[model samples]
Target: MATIRERAGRWQAIIKRKGYPQQSKTFDIKKDAEKWARQEERAMDAGTWADQSAAMQTTLAEALVRYEKEVTSGKKGADTERVRITKWKRHKLAQKALGTLKASDFAGYRDARLKDGAAAATVRLELAIISNLFNVARKEWSFEGLANPIEAMRLPTSKNARNRLFLDGEEARLLQALAPAARGEDGRFGDGCANPLLRPLVQLALATAMRRGELLALRWENIRLADRVAHLTDTKNGHSRDVPLSSAAAEVLRALPRAIRGPVFPITPNAVKLGFVRAVERARKRYEAEGGKDERMLSDLHFHDLRHIAVTALAEKLPNIVELAAVSGHQDVRMLRRYYHPKAEDLARKLG
Candidate 1:
């Protein structure tokens, strides 16, 4: 049954069905309301009209909770999904009913996110998560004929490959400042609370080009000391990679006292970050004291930049391009190019 009501100087068509709950939509005129009622009544008679308003009552937050439990766990990079879900829950979209969400609503959400000063890459990632949720709802969860509103919305262009790398002499100075053992009044190795684990971690990162999570997750069993390779099973690319060890890298690894527990780098991820922060602070203080103009040299250098340093070094040192790709575990040269820069001598030789 359908009924028309006037509320706040506008006409609304309300439809009540037996199996499903009631649904209502506002219209400008009585004829439009009557027309909609007739169309809905016919669709209901044919058993084809889905109660979209009832479906929409399921909020985005509720869908996110279901998605985290049902879908995200089975996928690659589930941790990333967890983070994305958290972000989505914080957004205005989370409060809206999933069924009532239109293409225009999503467009408003996108625009709002941009206005809030979110980077394009961040917005794109969030949108991808939302899009994936709708896809799951439609195909897997049996939300039949429910169109994805986000598909119709335009996305902002993401900035790729920001040139974050270590400048010359910065790496050496940073390493030098990271004391193996801080001196105390008694001048003992264990006197001060300097992290003995950090030096080897830095060297390994500069040698292997491994991500922070991969390095932190490294186990003693994965290390092939004789072959001079570190086997990385859990990687961003979802492929196991074997990172060859240089002599300097090997020496650092050999010097590290073995941990009795699970992880080779047994420090907490937070501890690792805190240690790096402290090291950077110390390095910055030293640089300023020395009257260097390049205060920005080590300021912008993240621990991840060590991987860039490793890749850049390999590209500059290795004669064969294919050989470099194999060792670095880069499937293509596209990403490898960003890290690689020819030495001044190599450039002079090429000119000659």
Candidate 2:
């Protein structure tokens, strides 16, 4: 049976049914209430009515906290989820309860987020986090009949093309700036001094094209200097991969003192980011001092861009660009293409 009640100047329909927890929803019209109740009844009879209240009772923030602690914390690459959770906490979707969130609510949130200058990629990521949370709720947390609202929603196309890469001269200049900073006097830089890891980090990124997380998680045992290969224990696709080390890359690894404890790159992810920031600052200052335009020298250079440089170099060296895709650990050729660039000689030959 379903009854209509007036509360908070809104018409709320309260339904009582077997196996269905008591459910209520506010509607503007009595007919709408009747229509929804009939639909719900059919769904309930078919054993398809997901307990919306069970899902809705948990707020997005609360769900994320639980997911982070119980689910993400157990994973090997859990830091990425932690970063996503931080972003979600600041998003409007985090304020809403999962049960009360209709498809329209998500649509509005998506639209509003776009209006507020969030990129399609960012919105898509937030949606993914939400969807994953609900999935965990249903499968792990015993929240029955909880439909993922995001399933009914379509996210905009993500702009994920790699537009940033180091040009020939750019890499040389960056290395020249980073080398002295990385190998400072006495092999250890003083506090407030330049990062001691910048050159080696850049070299590894350019040679291997490994993701930042993958690089940071590398262990000393994984680096086989004698074998000339670095065994990556796990990658983004949840597979173990072996990346061959270039001569220069091997030299960089040999130069590094073994970590006393865990990861080869023992610094926290935040520390890596901070080190990158400091390196960028130093590079910018040097560029300006040498009479270069501040904007031109610093234009669109990110730590991740070094991976693009590696992939591009490898693609140009081989006749089949697809061969390098395996080395770069890209599952798809389409993804590999984003980082591939034609060699200048090849371009010249084509022009001729």
Candidate 3:
């Protein structure tokens, strides 16, 4: 049953049904209110109104908040994702109802974000999280018929893959710069306390090709000192693999005093980023201070470039990609190739 009345110069429609909850709405005119009531009542009678009811109470911000608490909190990269979700919560789209989102809304967001100097990769990742939310809502939260708006939108093209490798003498310069910074006058890593970790950290990264996250996550229990293998319980690809440590890499680990039982290197990811950036700046400054020209100084180097150097070196020595994958944790041969950037001089030697 539905009833319409004029209340404060507006038509108010109150609908009641046997199996459904009571619905109420206000319209400028009685006819419009009556039309809405008729359509809703018909849809309810035919049992085709779940789409309207399922996501009516929940907004994208509310869903994402719940997701972060329930799902993203359990992830290894939870802090990073929590930050991204915080940004998402500030967007206008987040306030919209979960089922009310359209692809065109996101197209506008993508354009706006790009105009504001956000990278294509950053926007794509943001959209991916949104898509993940829709999938979770549909499959887990019972919001059926809700389509992922990302599927309707086209994503920005990703630029060329980074194949940055250490230039000649840059590796030595990085170590030289880090050597003094990792320690104080008393000689230590954290606030000049004890056991400076940067030199060993950089060396192990080159020798083992381990990611910054993997290195930071490493525990003493995971490292088999006798076998010289680091057991990774959680990798980026969601699979575990045993990484064999070279003698040099093993030496670095063996030298470090195990002060904490949880993580071998208890450092934040952002600390490593800031540390690397500072190291590069110091390295470049030192190089230019001497006879070295400004152009000759390593200004474009990144810490991850060490992984590329390690992979290419392994590719030169190792017989096959399978062997290289064991060291680098790359699941695909093509992805492994991206890291296997052999020096032109090394290739030129083969040509002769």
Please provide TM-scores, in order, for all candidate models, with all chains considered together: 0.74, 0.78, 0.78
| Backbone clash count, each prediction separately | 1, 2, 0
- Every candidate's lDDT: 0.77, 0.76, 0.82
The TM-score that candidate 3 achieves is: 0.78
lDDT (C-alpha) at residue 262 in model 1: 63
Tens-place lDDT digits, model 2, residues 1-352: 6888777766888889876678788888878887888788888888777766657678888888999999889876577669878887777777888776777777887898899998798788777877888888989888887778888987878776656865445666776667643445787764333656766887888877788878987888777888899888888788888888878878888888876446777666776666766766666677788888647565667777777767777776654656786688887788776556667997799889
Using lDDT, rank the candidates from best to worst: 3, 1, 2
lDDT of 1 by residue, 69-109 (tens): 99888865567668779878987878988887788877787
Candidates ranked by TM-score, best first?
A: 3, 2, 1
List candidate 1 segments past 4 Å from native: 5-54, 102-118, 172-199, 259-261, 266-295, 338-352
- lDDT (Cα, tens digit) per residue for candidate 3, span 14-108: 99888777888889999999999999888888878655566767899999998998889888887777878999999989999977789999999
Candidate 3: global Cα-lDDT? 0.82
Model 1: how large is the Cα RMSD against the reference?
A: 5.3
Point out the worst 10-residue segment of candidate 1 by lDDT: 184-193
